[model samples]
Target chain A: MRREGSAFQGVGAVFIKELSDNISSVRMLMLELLIVLTAMAALYEAIIALRQNTAEDPFLLLRLFTVSQAPLPSFVAVLGFLIPLMAIGLGFDLINSEHNRRTLSRILAQPIYRDALLLGKYLAGLATIAISLTALWLLVIGLGLIFLGVPPGGEEIARSLAFLVIAIFYAGVWLSLAMLLSIVFRSPATAALVALGIWLFLTVLWPMLAPAFAQMISPPDPRYAALGLDTPDTAIWTQLLQRFSPNDLFGEAMLAVLSPTTRTLGPVFLDQLRGAVMGAPLPFGESVMIAWPQTVGLIACTIVLFVAGYILFQRQEVRA
Target chain B: MSDQKPEGGAASPDVVIAARDLTKRYGKTSVVDAINFDIAKGEVFGLLGPNGAGKTTTILMMLGLTEISAGRVSVLGFDPARSPLQVKRRVGYLPDAVGFYDHLTAVENLAYAAKLMGLSMAERSQRIVAALSRVRLLDVANKRVATFSRGMRQRLGLAEVIVKRAEIAILDEPTSGLDPQATLEFLDLIRELKAEGVSVLLSSHMLDQVQRVCDRVALFRTGKIVMMGSVAELAVQVLGAGFVVEVEADGAGIARRLAAIPGVGNVETLAEDRFRMTADRDVRPDAARAVVAANGALRRLSVDEPSLEAIYAHYFQASQSGGVRDAA
Candidate 1:
């Protein structure tokens, strides 16, 4: 069908409006402040924790993210817990509020197609996430400089930026999932609760359940049990099942980006480790390759959830 | 009461909107069952019906918001279902309950609408001012719409409609839940739009409301137009050459005595001292003689046709007797 305007004509308008709304909203402010305060505390603890591991450091800036003091998790772990909340907070009311306030029909009556509206909302959400993540990152870097009294090398900065991008991509999956729920459920409370339930299941319950599930699928070999050793096959299947969780993909990508000495994320046999020097850093490009599939998984999940939301929203009746 | 094609359209007064056997079905139920009509340029056409009479559904179909299950609707020479963008860009809609971004200022809301309409920054500011001033909202342009009253929101909605500069404005129950003054203002705004040659299609359940502004109207019942024409045409069709006489003759039994007359058919008593009588034949003289002969001094009398409500009731009864289920 021939359309009047370009497919993306109204996307820019919606993006600008939504971005301003997100940034100026009190909810985002509270969430950002929480993330920033936790980041500052975690970075401060990391500074004290990583003081002695200065010899032969290639990606030293990333140490700020992985190192932690007692009673406080690492910066990466804090982000893993906080980013989903921030993303869900931003998205849980995005579409349902339009319905509740009865503005959806008025907006849809405009000259643009449904494609622009959904795309615009998603892009605005991604932009907000990027801005908040970038600010938090710069704060961490600045804190590292003050406490450690040394600027990070270029390689460290590059690796840290890559980790930041991967983190944002991971958050996008939850954001898209939250938005899909928002479109599906008319009540914001229900949407937020369902999204949080899924997140909790995937992050906390899925890891414990995956082993039992994988054992049912591929149980340990009885012949290997006769040799007084459990088979690697069970571990391999459990790891494979665990990888389906976005949290695991995020953790794997974070490890590859922050610690170059880490070679493989999945099950690795001793034969594959031949001639590999322990604690030797891989090149920057190879580190990206190692983490590429995890990043792609996060991105693919985001796209799948967004497409589902878009289709449902488009098929809905505008009368309401 | 005559529904002549309205005048003052600078553009061609040809059909701006046309429907042919347009039907909308949900599963097996047809909500808008095979409706057909044409709205000319600058014409103020009314879709007059009570609630659940398919007025809103027909408007949705015409605007291409609802899918047409069968047949077609053409708005400005384009099939709305096929090219809805083109149709919507030129059509402005005021829904039953208008909504706006309450957190945004009035100007901000209109500016957003202008941006979606492809206006530039310079054009947006210029048109927003012009549109708001036209709707008498320029003084409160910078105020947040949350603080605005319902009438103000409705006016802002009209401003947004005008800022788009659409050729057609479709209003669904625009004056619902408004005070009489606000309703009059809303009607005046519609008249201004009509004067500017915008094809106006509004739906209402109020006969007087439609008769005041609409050039022509279609009375709908159960998703069908039971009778469609100007107010005069409907009155003539239902009450052909009938004279309804209201007589103020002081008596306790004027209504019964009027019904006992030779030609009077529909007798409604305004009071014990007043009676309203309608008849196919001329019964004014006989009615006056009967009143005076009843030893009741005739204080006042007037011979006029029945109101549109009475005509509607007649058509409603006609449709019910024809085995159409409760088409009122």
Candidate 2:
């Protein structure tokens, strides 16, 4: 007799187990510490820069993410580098280690379906990333309040909150990617390295290569451009190609949400800005709209990676 | 020869597990090929085989962990492939190598299992405590599994199977890696489960242990069950109805002389004062007389039925000879 099994029958149980396991693991603790230290260091430097600035930037709270000191990078840039590491740290050994420890078969023998187990693990990882980002966000706010002495308005809080949400989404893409690598690779170390390799390629090398690739794909026409080898089409194509990298999307989304004065992610002509004030802050809705596509793109990438991993895992034979 | 299907009315076999020509093939080679057996309610069934004889493969297929290439298996009237949750819900599987989250305490590990079983918070805690105590691990319940010895881990596994209160328990190599005392204790636990009417299907290479616990056993070899019967039935089938008498005395050339006696099938010198003789009838009188005539004092004489060990050796030797004949 086939019972009508609930898809989410044991999700809560597995979710609790996964969350507790991640929370207690020394490995997770170390990764969280690394992210927090880097984020706080970046924020401290931003506060220092804000103290010396004399310009009355209407979006000063938002500038905390984009502005940096001499030795440190911006909070957004630091997170762009470290968020993937945190995700990979939590995810690289998720499945294979169960096999290594000889627990997979035993765990699967439980009444729960495999769907619950995978969903629970993924949700736990996303929750871990969410919690860390929330702490970092609150830390930045606390530092800003201490240094600037004036409480941030609702608009600043909303923008920072949006940036945090996007950061979590960006981290989820890498987390799911790392989880997929973990499923594919039997060795945990290999999984971690491969996930990191992909992250490094996207974050560090893609920006430099994207422009060149874009130029080649949509190279200038000599009939339109005499002196300028790169056309306006090339710039637009470069922006589109760069968006392929999760890091690029993450950086652009943060910039749009944190720097409300940022009117467009792509090239903007002076004619389009003729009537616009030079440094006017965009309304919260406009800022969200500006980052909307990037946020959706990051989320879509996470979902796609997770679905591939799930399909692959479902096909795999459960042997320990 | 008789599979004893439960559908045979009047017998009321109450089959908990029934497999018909079950097979598992990885590519071209079949690992568990066309094997069939039935484990009835409260019966302890043993799958005795050498390493890699496909005992684990069969168990995996039964649990729906591995896809079966051909044939069908029904557990508790449910097809594992189609209704794995229903099968898993009713069956308790103790894997060959029992493992747990080493970081968690014994209580936490059992609690996790209870949660997956969907026990309420109150029932979960009560069962965890009862299960730990049942396995005699209550004293170490709070200790991390990392600190547990191999025997303790095995006990925990047994407790897990017990706590589930399932209709059928599939224990794969349950006694492996444990000390002799622990294995004894583990077997005792299996007996207790059987007393409670839990059908057990245990796979092990240890013939003696299986002989003691299993009501029926299937001798597995090279991806197939070569012989299936109760231990007594196998003993009779292989060696025939006879008693083997060991004459504890070494009479020089006495072994051959004893073979001449009527109803005596064979004789072998056991040690410096011992000769073993096989007979189809009561031959102890003749054995004693033969030993005395050979000028050896028959210090001791003991009669025993053919053992499972002897039966296994005989079957393997017979199969090897058959193979040679077919090849020639």
Candidate 3:
């Protein structure tokens, strides 16, 4: 083994080791098995709905695979809520568990940088989520084609793929955040709880409270506000308040993906088709770009948290 | 490996690790204060000390695992603080408690470590087998570590450290939890490491093990090396010219006469006839003549050098009485 090998190879090695270990874990296998069984049940239910003709929309059958999405908003809301929890669970203990096993010192004694450990664990988590999500997506699409007697149109296919990527990136953001938490906290249990608490706060409670909290903190004036005219001052303040929540960014990305008419408030890429054009739906690549800033922001936040954790880990004394 | 001479020195034997003024402090208290030492290639160097004596702290600094408050450390010609990656590549460290994934088998644990060390597939297999064999754990290589006894875990820990064939091995209390048989086996493996010219720094409170395996030992007390030298040299220094002479005297009056001798400091009667005397130097001949002149019979004359345990006790007592001043 020459020392001249690229440092990325070290990260690749760790990634492979983590991925193999994850697949071999009984707990992970059980979870995947349960997911597969659930998908089968959902498929059977979708087929029954299609045969009965009681269901007005056939696309509503996809809801059986996950939660009920009778209202379109409910579908977005359910996925938005569930994805972060899964992400947090997948990555909450990746680093701290190694520390608990006392293998951290030994692994670090190798000739690789500390960044490799963080990046490898992140990549492994991302890969696992991607594979699992892709499998489920294919299973649902397969069931849809067979039961509904309708192969998804190109637009629907495009939307599903776009949704899958968004879901993955959403999960990835949480995974990275959880990994960062794992590095910051010494105990795996504490890291998991903190990550879960953060997930619940952001996905469930924060959105519910943000508007009320914003109104209370910065009340709108009744005199001019009653004129039914929107003020730039109030609009800027509201936008600032909304940015405080990660859900807003995720919601914007989801809206851009699900609704053909919706466009993100940014300069449209003239060279490339921006958002989903009426006739020519948004391609997967174009969709990713529209959501690019949010993805990058989430990824950057993950990196910053991880970098801080890495610095702390490097400085920690491995006494026992 | 080629035998190239190290720069800035004669083609002397390779010194795998060296520390000059190596110091570590925790806030106001200095744990390891300005200690100078060098580990010669292939020698088993022991840092012998009581608890709270900063042995572990010193080892951590050498491994680049702890921040050095002051001083310099070089392992395998690489400065630990500046070039930690290079230092880590050539060094294998076994911390005090050798914890591992209990669910993983011995072979799996070693394989994981080997992979982390970037060993190739063929090299990993070879090294894993060799390490397991070296530690005498080859039979239980497939057994999960959770099922292993403490002694077995210690052996596995040793196996992991040597799996990389590192040039310098830093083991902190490597055999602390082992039984006599396992301890001996572990010592034998250490001896083998010495034969391969791998420098080993073993931190232990086991005086007997240190005496047997270490060529040179440093006795640390209150975050400082109170005494350091080869075992023989230490024995010579602590024991000095020594012997005790006990004479069977007539009565208390004769004991007084023996004490009155210019060379003898204090005298006491052991029984109805026997008396003991303390001498500042080897005054055996003079004391014997004096006893004879007083018609006292010499019952026993023996030379007693202080044991390593006694030397350790004496130095610790001296250090305490010296008002716990910091050591250089």
Candidate 4:
């Protein structure tokens, strides 16, 4: 049957309500505090480490994000690990909490379609992540200015802002995955645990497993092996397998944006590097071009996960 | 058992809700089988049955919260399945064990609902205040719902309906968990909604509670409504004018003597002496005379007004015992 009215009739209302709820929630507070503290520590270590190598490097400010001292990862690395945790924390209980509280039917009984509730929640979660990430980005840059005593180039600001946006998309991928679990499971705790477990597997284990799976799928050429050269086919296969994990896509995108000196994210033949300055930083546009595919991958994964959750939630019974 | 159409057709302006042969099936099992009913504006219509008897399923179908396997339901001249937003905009629902955001204050909770209803900010606060006051929760308007008792939460649920200014209110087991005192207060609030000309559809397993507040009720068994009508009408149909005279007296063969009364149809022995007679008319005086003539000492004599509880029991009992008269 064709349902009457716009499916998005009350989306704004749900969005505003969910946004406020996410912002004021105790879970959000704890996640924000954790991210802020770790980010500050990473920033401090990056500045101390960068002080020893103040030279003709024009991208010193960019190095503040990627440079790390022993015993602590860089700021971008810390974000790569913590962003998914924050997104999952905000979203794992989104739907099931309503079920547990017996509020799903009442809320759905309002003058809105199921589309409004799911979309509103996803947008609100993304917005919350965006706000927190932007704040942390500003804090890091402001601290870098005070500690490093150097102003970032206009291109550097643009790249980091793009990084902030991509980080939000990265957070979106995890948020949608968490929401899917929330719709699939009736218990919030179960959803949370399963989301965390998936995060651990994708971020920690998948990187290690990707190479083995790739070698099994595409063995290196014996001629290339005898020549003491890595097979391009196995290298391509590994990157393809690794891209399945959102962490890999986000990590590569962060590398391209923060470390402009990175010329290529995949295998580059000798012919492609004919006239390239080995360690020279690529232009901002070239760097974004390199990260563009990964950025799109993050967004596409988020939409796919979100649509899957929407379908499940639409079919789910309202009675608890 | 019967899907009698209301006197007027679906075009009748006064019929706020009309369902014809509405059915809900999950796989081969039908949770709600073909059923029909119409609720007039301002009528308190109750769906009464035991747990798992499809009352909640029927209610969900009415709101278009669940898909209907067959037939049609129209709420306020719109098919609930096709125009759910229109139906929902005009109808308010309070689910069994209604919940609110525990961290938000009562006013804040209602304000969210108000926004969903598209109420302007000025009107939102005004309606919220009026609604909270109507449900007697105004003093706790700013208090978080976590501190609320079950009864308080129920009243807050009602407050949400009031804030919406809905034309019809669907309540599923509204008084299930409330204490007797709070239940009475909630019923009174339902009556107040009726007095203000809002139609109500209430579903519950508690026969006595429905009997008090509902103007008409549908008695559900399994997936179908076995009987539907006013309490007095059901009593007459199921109980044969539905009068019961109880005689608590001591004597020999008093049961047989009471059964011999002219208007009495069935005589049940409560004990060696006490007898309960289902009669077409008030037979208390005749029962006492019969007991006396049987050399029974009449200690007590009274008429037990036929209630919905009795009708439900009688309908289910007769059907279960292979008695086909009432079932037919």
Order of models, best lDDT first? 4, 2, 1, 3
lDDT of 2 by residue, A160-256 (tens): 8998889999999998999899899989999999998998899889999998998799987785588754578888999999999999999888888
The runs of at least 3 residues in candidate 3 whose Cα sits more than 4 Å from the true structure, single-residue gaps closed, are A1-9, A30-76, A221-243, A264-290, B1-12, B26-29, B239-306, B324-328
Worst 10 residues of 2 chain A by lDDT: A1-10
Candidate 2, residues B222-265, lDDT tens digits: the string is: 89998998876787678774578877766576777688789887
Could you tell me the TM-score of candidate 2?
0.89
TM-score quality measure for candidate 1: 0.88
The CA-based lDDT of model 2 is what?
0.86
Q: Sorted by DockQ, highest first, which candidate order results? A: 4, 2, 3, 1
lDDT against the true structure, each candidate: 0.85, 0.86, 0.72, 0.90
Per-residue CA lDDT of model 3 for B115-220, tens digit only, reads 8787899999998998898888999999989999878888787887788778888888888878899889888888988888888899999888877788889988
Top model number, lDDT: 4
| Superposition TM-score, candidate 4 onto the true structure | 0.91
Worst 10 residues of 3 chain A by lDDT: A64-73
Best by DockQ: 4
| Model 3, residue A50: C-alpha shift (Å) | 7.7
Q: Lowest-scoring 10 consecutive residues by lDDT in candidate 3 chain B? A: B1-10
TM-score list, all predictions: 0.88, 0.89, 0.80, 0.91
Please identify model 4 stretches exceeding 4 Å from their true place.
A221-228, B1-11, B245-302, B323-328
lDDT of 1 by residue, A1-320 (tens): 45455778799999999999999999999999999999788888888877866675656678889987888989998898889989998999889988887777778778888788888888899899999999888988988888877788888899989988998998899999999999999999999999999989998999999999988988889998999865788888998899999999998999998988889887788899999998899988889999999999999999999989998987777776
lDDT score of residue B263 within candidate 4: 69
For lDDT, candidate 2 versus 3, the one ahead is 2
> Which candidate, 1 or 4, would have the higher lDDT against the true structure?
4
